[model samples]
Target: MRSTVADVMTTEVASVGEDAGYKEIVSTLLERGVSALPVLDGENRVVGVVSEEDLLHKVEFENDTSARAYWPPMRARLRARLSGAGALAERADEKAAGRTAAHLMSTPAVTVAPAALVIEAARLMERRGVKRLPVVDGTGALVGVVSRRDLLRVFSRSDSDIAAAVEDQVAEVSRWDRGEINAVVEDGVVTLSGPVRRRSVAHALAGAVCGVEGVVAVTNNLDWEIDDVAPYPQMGV
Candidate 1:
């Protein structure tokens, strides 16, 4: 079965309340060896995420005569322009003077459900440019945290286990016995070689094997009896 975020997440996560002081957040992060902390409200529901980058923004602007030089790219130019230059400058100054997690955190925290697939968490992290994600329950309460390292644990599955899973996937996809389609796994690479009844079955088998957990790569050497993918000649259409 595919692993979910809960399967590998660290349940004992370190989090900070919205009113937590900046120095307290920094100390918690260092003590826990985490790069970010989920900001929780009074009800223990996650409201935001405060990362190293968010904290660095304060230091980046502090004592700087020209904050524009340290400003992030114009990714939010439309919003900045709409708010006006003065408002944007005020916001940066506010962040620099901020003392609480609520003031410094990135709101609408990028969170993932505990039941989400590990791949889904990995993709969300990549798309959001985060190194970790807060695993929340249905009520938005923090249950755990999943990092890049946690999601990569699936790759540690034994070679034998991967091979067995590949064989099972091939059998289910093609309804072919071991003799009809052979699967050999080395390290995490799968090499399938044998004869298939239909061209479509070969493609299906390869794709199914590729989805198996711990599969590093797939080398398909299967031959088919018929060219099922070829277009048929039109007859007086």
Candidate 2:
């Protein structure tokens, strides 16, 4: 079975209340050595997240735009414009005026369920451009937190373990001969090579091996005797 959020998430998470002050949030982040903290309500339910970038906005926008002696150089402005940093700066300026977590945090915290697959959590973080996700229950209460590092723990499994799993779970289940189908694992990459009765079986075997935990990549080099899905030639009278 695939590893879930609960399998590798850190149950002891550093969080802040909605009423936490800016300095307190900074202190917690620095002391805990975490990039962000989940903001919870009175019910301990996650509402948002306050990150180091969120706190930096205060320093970035401390001076008003009108106070500048001269406009930024054309090149600098062009780079900012291309990266959308200009728009982000405007929003940061607005956030800088706030004094508490409620006003400073990014709302609608991106979260995952404890039962969610680790890959799902990784995809969520990638899609949202965040480094971590709060693990929440069905009621949205924070239970733990999962980071990119946690999701990558699967890759640390020994190569022997990966090969064993592929051989037992994938090849045997697919009815492929243990000797015929060679399962070679190296640095989490699995290479399946041999002969199979049908092309479909080869594809299915490869996919199954790919889903195994700690398998970084799958190389299928199975020669098939028959192409089951190939269209047949028309007959002529």
Candidate 3:
């Protein structure tokens, strides 16, 4: 059965304005727990994707540079020295905070119509080496996003059948030796709320649950805290 882009893409995507401050943009991405955000214009059309990697470029431009960098068309030796190693980098770091999405965006975006076939979307994703494909209307308003995770939904059995499978998996996980590693699942939302010794464990746990048949997404609430608070605060204690 062929599915449409609407069937696979995530509808609730985060976006930011093109003219927005670099600091604000980075904050929004972090708060939303997203590696990248679509930069949109006044019409809500996607102008570019601002990822963590792009942000780093802005940082580089801010912290490094020389006289030739600011004035340009200088003597050859000075220009050459300014262009070398730490010079440009220092200028990059200094200028990064001022850089806007308009300066960094790679556009015009590659988009697919909502009615595009899932197989076509898969091909596009594979060819582009991009994990997410944005579904859009003729006017370029973002409608949804599809990724390899959505593609795996193709193999899902039925709801009743998957319910039993989830139960069995949950039971097995419960028996696993985990002290502070908490596991929770409800209605396709899996929440891992606990502290683990290593970052790898946190990632592995999230990945394992997200790989489960009925799991739509895994929210890793794990925190590696050095201090512990009382589970129940005594009255005035």
Question: lDDT for each of the candidates?
Answer: 0.87, 0.88, 0.67
Estimate the TM-score of every prediction.
0.86, 0.84, 0.52
Error in Å for residue 105 of model 1: 0.4
| lDDT of each residue in 1-237, candidate 3, tens digit only | 356778877898877888877778788888988777777889988877777776787555553567326754458547667669457544454446546877655456667788887778878878876666667788888777676788767546454554455445444544552436556556566677766555555555567666655566778887653333336667986
Residue runs of model 2 more than 4 Å from their true location after superposition: 65-90, 173-179, 229-237
C-alpha RMSD between model 1 and the true structure: 4.6
Q: Tens digits of per-residue lDDT for model 1 on 20-119?
A: 9999999998999989999999998999999898888788887777755666557676577777975766666777778999998888999999889988
The residue-by-residue lDDT of candidate 2 on 21-103, one tens digit each, is 99999999999999999999999999999999889888876775674445789999889989999877666776788799998
lDDT of 3: 0.67
| Model number with the top TM-score | 1
